[model samples]
Target: MRAKIYGGCVSRDILNFDEAELIKLVSYNARSSLATLGSNNAAKNISKKHYDSLLNIESKFQRRMVESDFNNQILESAGKGDYDLLLIDFLVDRFHLAEIEGKLVTRSVEFLRSGIKPDRVVNTFSDQYLKLWKEGVDNLFNTVNNTVGLEAIRINKVYWTSVATNPQDSMMLNEKWDIEKNNAKLDAMYEYVENILPSSSIIEVDKNLLVADSDHKWGLSPFHFTDDYYRRMVKIFNA
Candidate 1:
Protein backbone atom coordinates (compact mmCIF):
# COMPACT_ATOMS: atom_id res chain seq x y z
CA MET A 1 0.00 0.00 0.00
CA ARG A 2 1.11 3.53 -0.74
CA ALA A 3 2.01 5.68 2.28
CA LYS A 4 3.60 9.05 3.25
CA ILE A 5 7.03 7.36 2.94
CA TYR A 6 8.27 6.09 -0.41
CA GLY A 7 9.13 2.42 -0.18
CA GLY A 8 10.76 2.34 -3.64
CA CYS A 9 13.57 4.79 -2.70
CA VAL A 10 15.07 2.16 -0.43
CA SER A 11 17.91 0.32 -2.17
CA ARG A 12 20.68 -2.12 -1.44
CA ASP A 13 23.13 0.73 -0.76
CA ILE A 14 21.03 2.26 2.03
CA LEU A 15 20.19 -1.10 3.61
CA ASN A 16 23.83 -2.06 3.52
CA PHE A 17 25.07 1.10 5.29
CA ASP A 18 24.75 -0.70 8.66
CA GLU A 19 25.11 0.98 12.05
CA ALA A 20 28.59 2.50 11.92
CA GLU A 21 28.43 4.23 8.53
CA LEU A 22 25.05 5.83 9.31
CA ILE A 23 26.13 7.47 12.58
CA LYS A 24 29.72 8.36 11.73
CA LEU A 25 29.09 12.05 11.02
CA VAL A 26 26.32 12.59 13.56
CA SER A 27 28.90 13.43 16.20
CA TYR A 28 30.17 16.82 15.10
CA ASN A 29 31.88 19.94 16.37
CA ALA A 30 30.10 23.06 17.67
CA ARG A 31 27.06 23.35 15.41
CA SER A 32 25.38 25.35 18.19
CA SER A 33 27.89 28.17 17.91
CA LEU A 34 26.82 28.89 14.34
CA ALA A 35 23.27 29.48 15.52
CA THR A 36 24.48 31.94 18.14
CA LEU A 37 26.46 33.81 15.52
CA GLY A 38 23.64 34.16 13.00
CA SER A 39 23.65 37.93 12.80
CA ASN A 40 24.65 39.86 9.64
CA ASN A 41 28.27 38.86 10.27
CA ALA A 42 27.46 35.15 10.02
CA ALA A 43 28.86 35.10 6.49
CA LYS A 44 32.37 35.50 7.92
CA ASN A 45 32.19 32.15 9.73
CA ILE A 46 31.42 30.15 6.54
CA SER A 47 33.46 29.34 3.46
CA LYS A 48 32.46 30.90 0.19
CA LYS A 49 32.76 29.09 -3.20
CA HIS A 50 35.00 26.09 -2.59
CA TYR A 51 38.38 26.13 -4.41
CA ASP A 52 37.57 29.63 -5.72
CA SER A 53 39.06 31.25 -2.61
CA LEU A 54 41.63 30.40 0.06
CA LEU A 55 38.88 28.81 2.19
CA ASN A 56 37.64 25.73 0.40
CA ILE A 57 34.72 23.92 2.01
CA GLU A 58 34.68 20.11 1.99
CA SER A 59 30.88 19.93 2.25
CA LYS A 60 29.23 22.65 0.16
CA PHE A 61 25.71 21.54 0.97
CA GLN A 62 26.25 21.83 4.71
CA ARG A 63 27.96 25.19 4.30
CA ARG A 64 25.13 26.59 2.19
CA MET A 65 22.63 25.50 4.83
CA VAL A 66 24.70 27.32 7.43
CA GLU A 67 24.87 30.50 5.37
CA SER A 68 21.17 30.70 4.63
CA ASP A 69 19.20 33.44 6.44
CA PHE A 70 16.27 31.05 6.79
CA ASN A 71 18.36 28.79 9.01
CA ASN A 72 19.47 31.77 11.10
CA GLN A 73 15.89 32.58 12.05
CA ILE A 74 15.31 28.99 13.18
CA LEU A 75 18.50 28.75 15.26
CA GLU A 76 18.12 32.07 17.09
CA SER A 77 14.63 31.12 18.21
CA ALA A 78 15.92 28.03 19.99
CA GLY A 79 19.02 29.78 21.27
CA LYS A 80 16.83 32.27 23.16
CA GLY A 81 13.98 29.96 24.11
CA ASP A 82 12.25 30.93 27.42
CA TYR A 83 9.00 29.02 27.53
CA ASP A 84 9.64 27.05 30.73
CA LEU A 85 7.94 29.49 33.11
CA LEU A 86 4.90 29.60 30.88
CA LEU A 87 4.87 25.83 30.64
CA ILE A 88 5.02 25.46 34.39
CA ASP A 89 2.19 27.93 34.87
CA PHE A 90 0.05 25.96 32.43
CA LEU A 91 0.69 22.78 34.36
CA VAL A 92 -0.27 24.36 37.65
CA ASP A 93 -3.21 26.54 36.64
CA ARG A 94 -4.72 24.54 33.80
CA PHE A 95 -3.97 21.01 34.93
CA HIS A 96 -4.45 21.78 38.63
CA LEU A 97 -1.18 20.04 39.53
CA ALA A 98 0.09 22.76 41.94
CA GLU A 99 0.10 20.58 45.06
CA ILE A 100 2.37 18.04 43.40
CA GLU A 101 4.14 20.76 41.36
CA GLY A 102 5.64 22.22 44.56
CA LYS A 103 7.80 25.38 44.57
CA LEU A 104 7.74 27.84 41.66
CA VAL A 105 9.15 31.29 40.92
CA THR A 106 8.20 34.04 38.48
CA ARG A 107 10.27 35.19 35.53
CA SER A 108 9.75 38.12 33.20
CA VAL A 109 8.19 37.21 29.84
CA GLU A 110 8.29 40.77 28.51
CA PHE A 111 10.61 39.62 25.78
CA LEU A 112 7.91 37.58 24.08
CA ARG A 113 6.28 40.44 22.17
CA SER A 114 9.36 42.68 22.06
CA GLY A 115 11.12 40.54 19.44
CA ILE A 116 13.95 40.33 21.94
CA LYS A 117 15.23 36.96 23.18
CA PRO A 118 16.46 37.73 26.68
CA ASP A 119 20.11 37.20 27.54
CA ARG A 120 21.18 33.62 28.32
CA VAL A 121 17.60 32.41 28.15
CA VAL A 122 18.41 28.72 28.29
CA ASN A 123 21.40 28.81 30.65
CA THR A 124 19.94 31.37 33.02
CA PHE A 125 16.48 29.83 33.12
CA SER A 126 17.85 26.36 33.76
CA ASP A 127 20.01 27.75 36.53
CA GLN A 128 16.91 28.96 38.34
CA TYR A 129 15.23 25.56 37.93
CA LEU A 130 18.07 24.07 39.97
CA LYS A 131 16.09 25.00 43.09
CA LEU A 132 12.49 25.21 41.80
CA TRP A 133 11.85 22.54 39.17
CA LYS A 134 12.33 18.80 39.33
CA GLU A 135 14.81 18.77 36.40
CA GLY A 136 17.45 21.00 34.93
CA VAL A 137 17.48 22.64 31.51
CA ASP A 138 20.51 20.63 30.43
CA ASN A 139 18.61 18.98 27.56
CA LEU A 140 17.09 22.32 26.70
CA PHE A 141 20.58 23.79 26.65
CA ASN A 142 21.79 20.85 24.52
CA THR A 143 18.92 21.40 22.10
CA VAL A 144 19.77 25.04 21.43
CA ASN A 145 23.46 24.25 21.84
CA ASN A 146 23.34 21.97 18.77
CA THR A 147 21.82 22.00 15.31
CA VAL A 148 19.71 18.94 16.09
CA GLY A 149 17.51 21.01 18.44
CA LEU A 150 16.66 23.33 15.56
CA GLU A 151 16.00 20.31 13.33
CA ALA A 152 13.78 18.65 15.94
CA ILE A 153 11.33 21.60 15.94
CA ARG A 154 10.13 20.70 12.39
CA ILE A 155 8.75 24.29 12.12
CA ASN A 156 11.88 25.19 10.18
CA LYS A 157 10.71 23.06 7.30
CA VAL A 158 7.48 24.98 7.38
CA TYR A 159 9.39 28.28 7.31
CA TRP A 160 11.46 27.09 4.35
CA THR A 161 8.26 25.95 2.65
CA SER A 162 6.83 29.43 3.16
CA VAL A 163 9.79 31.31 1.64
CA ALA A 164 11.29 28.96 -0.96
CA THR A 165 10.09 29.18 -4.58
CA ASN A 166 6.91 27.16 -4.89
CA PRO A 167 4.45 27.45 -7.79
CA GLN A 168 1.80 26.13 -5.46
CA ASP A 169 1.91 29.24 -3.26
CA SER A 170 2.57 32.52 -5.07
CA MET A 171 1.00 34.71 -2.38
CA MET A 172 3.58 33.77 0.22
CA LEU A 173 6.35 34.53 -2.26
CA ASN A 174 5.16 38.11 -2.61
CA GLU A 175 5.40 38.82 1.11
CA LYS A 176 8.73 40.57 1.46
CA TRP A 177 10.59 40.06 4.73
CA ASP A 178 12.03 43.20 6.28
CA ILE A 179 15.68 42.14 6.43
CA GLU A 180 16.84 45.11 8.51
CA LYS A 181 14.19 44.52 11.18
CA ASN A 182 15.03 40.84 11.59
CA ASN A 183 18.76 41.57 11.64
CA ALA A 184 18.37 44.09 14.43
CA LYS A 185 16.55 41.56 16.57
CA LEU A 186 19.16 38.90 15.83
CA ASP A 187 22.05 41.26 16.56
CA ALA A 188 20.60 42.14 19.94
CA MET A 189 20.43 38.47 20.99
CA TYR A 190 23.78 37.09 19.77
CA GLU A 191 25.81 38.01 22.86
CA TYR A 192 23.50 36.18 25.26
CA VAL A 193 23.44 33.04 23.10
CA GLU A 194 27.22 32.62 23.22
CA ASN A 195 27.17 30.82 26.56
CA ILE A 196 25.18 27.55 26.42
CA LEU A 197 24.83 24.15 28.04
CA PRO A 198 27.54 21.61 27.29
CA SER A 199 26.84 17.97 26.50
CA SER A 200 28.35 15.08 24.53
CA SER A 201 25.05 13.88 23.07
CA ILE A 202 25.30 11.64 20.02
CA ILE A 203 22.92 12.14 17.09
CA GLU A 204 20.91 8.97 16.43
CA VAL A 205 18.83 9.63 13.33
CA ASP A 206 19.71 7.12 10.60
CA LYS A 207 20.73 4.43 13.08
CA ASN A 208 17.60 4.58 15.18
CA LEU A 209 14.95 7.30 14.66
CA LEU A 210 15.16 7.58 10.83
CA VAL A 211 15.20 4.30 8.91
CA ALA A 212 13.03 2.56 6.37
CA ASP A 213 12.12 -1.01 5.54
CA SER A 214 12.40 -0.13 1.82
CA ASP A 215 12.55 3.43 0.41
CA HIS A 216 14.95 5.85 -1.33
CA LYS A 217 13.65 8.86 0.60
CA TRP A 218 17.04 10.24 1.65
CA GLY A 219 16.24 13.97 1.67
CA LEU A 220 15.85 16.88 -0.71
CA SER A 221 17.13 19.66 1.57
CA PRO A 222 18.23 20.00 5.20
CA PHE A 223 14.65 19.70 6.45
CA HIS A 224 12.21 19.10 3.56
CA PHE A 225 11.83 15.49 2.42
CA THR A 226 10.49 13.88 -0.73
CA ASP A 227 7.86 11.17 -1.19
CA ASP A 228 10.37 8.52 -0.23
CA TYR A 229 11.34 10.52 2.84
CA TYR A 230 7.78 10.77 4.03
CA ARG A 231 7.26 7.07 3.32
CA ARG A 232 10.33 6.19 5.37
CA MET A 233 9.13 8.53 8.10
CA VAL A 234 5.88 6.61 8.28
CA LYS A 235 7.90 3.45 8.71
CA ILE A 236 9.90 5.07 11.51
CA PHE A 237 6.79 6.33 13.35
CA ASN A 238 5.17 2.92 13.05
CA ALA A 239 8.27 1.16 14.29
Candidate 2:
Protein backbone atom coordinates (compact mmCIF):
# COMPACT_ATOMS: atom_id res chain seq x y z
CA MET A 1 0.00 0.00 0.00
CA ARG A 2 1.32 3.39 -1.01
CA ALA A 3 0.18 6.05 1.43
CA LYS A 4 0.39 9.83 1.77
CA ILE A 5 0.02 11.21 5.25
CA TYR A 6 -1.01 14.62 6.53
CA GLY A 7 -1.33 16.12 10.01
CA GLY A 8 0.96 14.18 12.39
CA CYS A 9 3.27 11.25 13.18
CA VAL A 10 0.59 8.72 14.12
CA SER A 11 0.03 7.42 10.60
CA ARG A 12 3.63 7.84 9.56
CA ASP A 13 4.92 5.96 12.56
CA ILE A 14 2.42 3.17 12.02
CA LEU A 15 3.36 2.79 8.35
CA ASN A 16 7.06 3.04 9.16
CA PHE A 17 6.92 0.48 11.94
CA ASP A 18 8.43 -2.97 11.23
CA GLU A 19 5.01 -4.56 11.59
CA ALA A 20 3.73 -2.44 8.69
CA GLU A 21 6.46 -3.34 6.19
CA LEU A 22 3.93 -3.94 3.44
CA ILE A 23 2.84 -0.32 3.58
CA LYS A 24 5.01 2.20 1.79
CA LEU A 25 4.83 5.88 2.68
CA VAL A 26 4.67 7.91 -0.52
CA SER A 27 4.56 11.35 1.07
CA TYR A 28 4.30 12.79 4.56
CA ASN A 29 3.30 16.38 5.27
CA ALA A 30 3.12 17.66 8.81
CA ARG A 31 2.72 20.75 11.00
CA SER A 32 -0.06 21.88 8.67
CA SER A 33 -3.78 22.41 9.08
CA LEU A 34 -6.71 21.99 6.70
CA ALA A 35 -7.17 25.76 7.01
CA THR A 36 -3.73 26.49 5.53
CA LEU A 37 -3.74 23.93 2.69
CA GLY A 38 -6.35 25.72 0.54
CA SER A 39 -5.06 29.25 1.16
CA ASN A 40 -3.72 31.45 -1.63
CA ASN A 41 -1.25 33.87 -0.14
CA ALA A 42 1.23 36.15 -1.89
CA ALA A 43 4.25 34.90 0.02
CA LYS A 44 4.21 31.17 -0.43
CA ASN A 45 7.70 30.89 1.01
CA ILE A 46 8.74 31.36 4.59
CA SER A 47 10.67 34.46 5.64
CA LYS A 48 14.47 34.16 5.51
CA LYS A 49 14.62 34.54 9.28
CA HIS A 50 12.20 31.66 9.74
CA TYR A 51 14.07 29.50 7.24
CA ASP A 52 17.34 30.22 9.01
CA SER A 53 15.80 29.12 12.28
CA LEU A 54 14.41 25.99 10.62
CA LEU A 55 17.94 24.92 9.74
CA ASN A 56 18.58 24.39 13.44
CA ILE A 57 15.79 21.82 13.69
CA GLU A 58 17.37 18.44 14.55
CA SER A 59 15.27 16.30 12.24
CA LYS A 60 15.47 16.83 8.48
CA PHE A 61 12.00 15.33 7.98
CA GLN A 62 10.61 17.90 10.39
CA ARG A 63 12.36 20.74 8.55
CA ARG A 64 10.86 19.59 5.25
CA MET A 65 7.39 19.30 6.80
CA VAL A 66 7.68 22.79 8.29
CA GLU A 67 8.68 24.22 4.92
CA SER A 68 5.82 22.36 3.25
CA ASP A 69 3.37 23.91 5.71
CA PHE A 70 4.69 27.42 5.01
CA ASN A 71 4.64 26.82 1.25
CA ASN A 72 1.01 25.60 1.48
CA GLN A 73 1.79 22.47 -0.52
CA ILE A 74 0.35 19.82 1.76
CA LEU A 75 -1.98 18.33 -0.84
CA GLU A 76 0.20 18.67 -3.93
CA SER A 77 1.63 15.12 -3.93
CA ALA A 78 -1.73 13.50 -3.28
CA GLY A 79 -3.20 15.01 -6.44
CA LYS A 80 -1.09 12.82 -8.71
CA GLY A 81 -2.76 9.60 -7.48
CA ASP A 82 0.56 7.85 -6.85
CA TYR A 83 -0.61 6.73 -3.43
CA ASP A 84 -3.45 4.34 -2.66
CA LEU A 85 -4.30 5.88 0.69
CA LEU A 86 -4.36 9.33 2.23
CA LEU A 87 -3.96 9.01 5.97
CA ILE A 88 -4.80 12.02 8.09
CA ASP A 89 -4.75 12.77 11.82
CA PHE A 90 -5.60 16.14 13.34
CA LEU A 91 -2.96 16.47 16.05
CA VAL A 92 -1.25 19.24 14.13
CA ASP A 93 -4.50 21.20 14.01
CA ARG A 94 -4.07 21.75 17.73
CA PHE A 95 -1.24 24.14 16.96
CA HIS A 96 -2.61 27.66 16.61
CA LEU A 97 -1.99 29.48 13.36
CA ALA A 98 0.34 32.44 13.26
CA GLU A 99 -0.14 35.27 10.80
CA ILE A 100 3.12 36.56 9.42
CA GLU A 101 3.30 39.15 6.67
CA GLY A 102 -0.35 38.50 5.74
CA LYS A 103 0.08 34.73 5.41
CA LEU A 104 -1.32 32.36 7.98
CA VAL A 105 1.16 29.60 8.88
CA THR A 106 0.88 26.76 11.39
CA ARG A 107 2.55 27.77 14.61
CA SER A 108 3.91 24.23 15.06
CA VAL A 109 5.87 23.02 18.03
CA GLU A 110 9.02 23.19 15.89
CA PHE A 111 8.27 26.80 15.01
CA LEU A 112 7.64 27.60 18.64
CA ARG A 113 10.92 25.94 19.65
CA SER A 114 12.82 27.90 16.96
CA GLY A 115 12.07 31.25 18.63
CA ILE A 116 10.91 33.01 15.47
CA LYS A 117 8.02 35.20 16.39
CA PRO A 118 5.07 35.80 14.07
CA ASP A 119 2.99 38.96 13.76
CA ARG A 120 0.01 37.47 15.60
CA VAL A 121 -1.42 34.20 16.81
CA VAL A 122 -4.93 33.17 15.76
CA ASN A 123 -6.93 31.32 18.39
CA THR A 124 -8.29 28.03 17.04
CA PHE A 125 -11.51 28.37 19.05
CA SER A 126 -12.59 31.58 17.34
CA ASP A 127 -15.52 31.67 14.91
CA GLN A 128 -13.21 32.95 12.18
CA TYR A 129 -10.95 29.94 12.65
CA LEU A 130 -13.89 27.55 12.29
CA LYS A 131 -15.00 29.37 9.15
CA LEU A 132 -11.57 29.00 7.60
CA TRP A 133 -11.41 25.33 8.62
CA LYS A 134 -14.78 24.61 7.03
CA GLU A 135 -13.73 26.26 3.78
CA GLY A 136 -10.51 24.27 3.73
CA VAL A 137 -12.36 21.05 4.41
CA ASP A 138 -14.64 21.70 1.44
CA ASN A 139 -11.62 22.24 -0.78
CA LEU A 140 -10.05 18.99 0.45
CA PHE A 141 -13.21 16.96 -0.16
CA ASN A 142 -13.50 18.19 -3.75
CA THR A 143 -9.80 17.65 -4.44
CA VAL A 144 -9.86 14.07 -3.14
CA ASN A 145 -13.03 13.24 -5.08
CA ASN A 146 -11.44 14.49 -8.29
CA THR A 147 -8.14 12.75 -7.62
CA VAL A 148 -7.97 9.73 -5.29
CA GLY A 149 -11.68 9.44 -4.45
CA LEU A 150 -13.20 9.02 -1.00
CA GLU A 151 -12.42 5.30 -0.71
CA ALA A 152 -8.68 5.98 -0.56
CA ILE A 153 -8.96 8.43 2.30
CA ARG A 154 -8.66 7.40 5.94
CA ILE A 155 -9.24 9.58 8.97
CA ASN A 156 -7.23 8.26 11.91
CA LYS A 157 -9.58 9.09 14.75
CA VAL A 158 -7.28 9.95 17.66
CA TYR A 159 -7.20 12.06 20.82
CA TRP A 160 -4.81 13.07 23.56
CA THR A 161 -4.17 10.28 26.05
CA SER A 162 -5.11 11.11 29.59
CA VAL A 163 -2.77 8.46 30.99
CA ALA A 164 0.86 7.40 30.46
CA THR A 165 2.72 4.17 31.08
CA ASN A 166 4.98 5.91 33.58
CA PRO A 167 3.56 7.74 36.53
CA GLN A 168 5.95 10.65 35.96
CA ASP A 169 4.85 11.04 32.37
CA SER A 170 1.21 10.92 33.42
CA MET A 171 1.75 13.74 35.88
CA MET A 172 3.58 15.82 33.30
CA LEU A 173 0.74 15.45 30.76
CA ASN A 174 -1.80 16.52 33.35
CA GLU A 175 0.35 19.54 34.26
CA LYS A 176 0.74 20.64 30.65
CA TRP A 177 -2.69 19.87 29.20
CA ASP A 178 -6.33 20.10 30.13
CA ILE A 179 -6.96 16.68 28.54
CA GLU A 180 -10.74 16.63 28.88
CA LYS A 181 -11.25 20.13 27.44
CA ASN A 182 -8.79 19.62 24.58
CA ASN A 183 -10.26 16.23 23.67
CA ALA A 184 -13.74 17.79 23.53
CA LYS A 185 -12.57 20.38 21.02
CA LEU A 186 -10.81 17.71 18.94
CA ASP A 187 -13.94 15.54 18.92
CA ALA A 188 -15.99 18.42 17.53
CA MET A 189 -13.47 19.02 14.75
CA TYR A 190 -13.29 15.30 13.93
CA GLU A 191 -17.08 15.12 13.78
CA TYR A 192 -17.11 17.96 11.28
CA VAL A 193 -14.65 16.15 9.04
CA GLU A 194 -16.51 12.86 9.35
CA ASN A 195 -19.71 14.62 8.30
CA ILE A 196 -17.92 15.90 5.17
CA LEU A 197 -16.77 12.45 4.04
CA PRO A 198 -19.31 10.01 5.41
CA SER A 199 -18.23 7.26 3.01
CA SER A 200 -14.53 7.39 3.84
CA SER A 201 -12.95 4.87 6.19
CA ILE A 202 -12.59 5.86 9.82
CA ILE A 203 -9.75 4.21 11.79
CA GLU A 204 -10.91 3.81 15.36
CA VAL A 205 -8.93 2.27 18.23
CA ASP A 206 -10.04 1.16 21.66
CA LYS A 207 -9.91 3.96 24.24
CA ASN A 208 -7.64 1.75 26.38
CA LEU A 209 -5.00 1.89 23.65
CA LEU A 210 -4.66 5.66 24.04
CA VAL A 211 -1.94 5.54 26.68
CA ALA A 212 1.19 7.69 26.29
CA ASP A 213 4.56 5.96 25.87
CA SER A 214 7.11 6.78 28.49
CA ASP A 215 9.97 5.73 26.21
CA HIS A 216 8.71 7.19 22.94
CA LYS A 217 11.38 8.49 20.58
CA TRP A 218 9.88 11.99 20.57
CA GLY A 219 9.54 11.97 24.36
CA LEU A 220 6.37 11.65 26.33
CA SER A 221 3.43 13.61 24.93
CA PRO A 222 -0.30 13.04 24.97
CA PHE A 223 -0.38 12.23 21.26
CA HIS A 224 2.74 10.05 21.28
CA PHE A 225 1.47 6.64 22.21
CA THR A 226 3.07 3.34 23.19
CA ASP A 227 4.28 0.69 20.74
CA ASP A 228 1.16 -1.29 21.54
CA TYR A 229 -0.96 1.53 20.19
CA TYR A 230 0.85 1.56 16.85
CA ARG A 231 0.70 -2.21 16.60
CA ARG A 232 -3.03 -2.25 17.30
CA MET A 233 -3.54 0.54 14.76
CA VAL A 234 -1.72 -1.46 12.09
CA LYS A 235 -3.80 -4.52 12.85
CA ILE A 236 -6.95 -2.47 12.55
CA PHE A 237 -5.78 -0.96 9.28
CA ASN A 238 -5.11 -4.39 7.85
CA ALA A 239 -8.49 -5.68 9.01
Give lDDT: candidate 1, residue 138: 33
TM-score of 1: 0.19
Query: Candidate 2 at residue 148, lDDT?
Result: 77
Candidate 1 residues 44-134, lDDT tens each?
A: 3322232132123345543333233212332344444332110000111010011101211111221122232222332322333222222
In the predicted model 2, the residue pairs found to clash are: none
Model 2 lDDT per residue over 39-111, tens place: 4542356668777788877888778877787776765666677888888887777778888777888888777
RMSD of every prediction: 21.1, 2.3
The deviation in Å at residue 195 for candidate 2 is 1.2
**Model 1 stretches with alpha carbons more than 4 Å out:** 1-20, 24-136, 139-161, 170-193, 197-239
lDDT agreement of model 2 with the native: 0.79
lDDT of 1: 0.25
Best by lDDT: 2
lDDT scores in order: 0.25, 0.79
Measured against the true structure, the TM-scores of the candidates, in listed sequence, are 0.19, 0.89
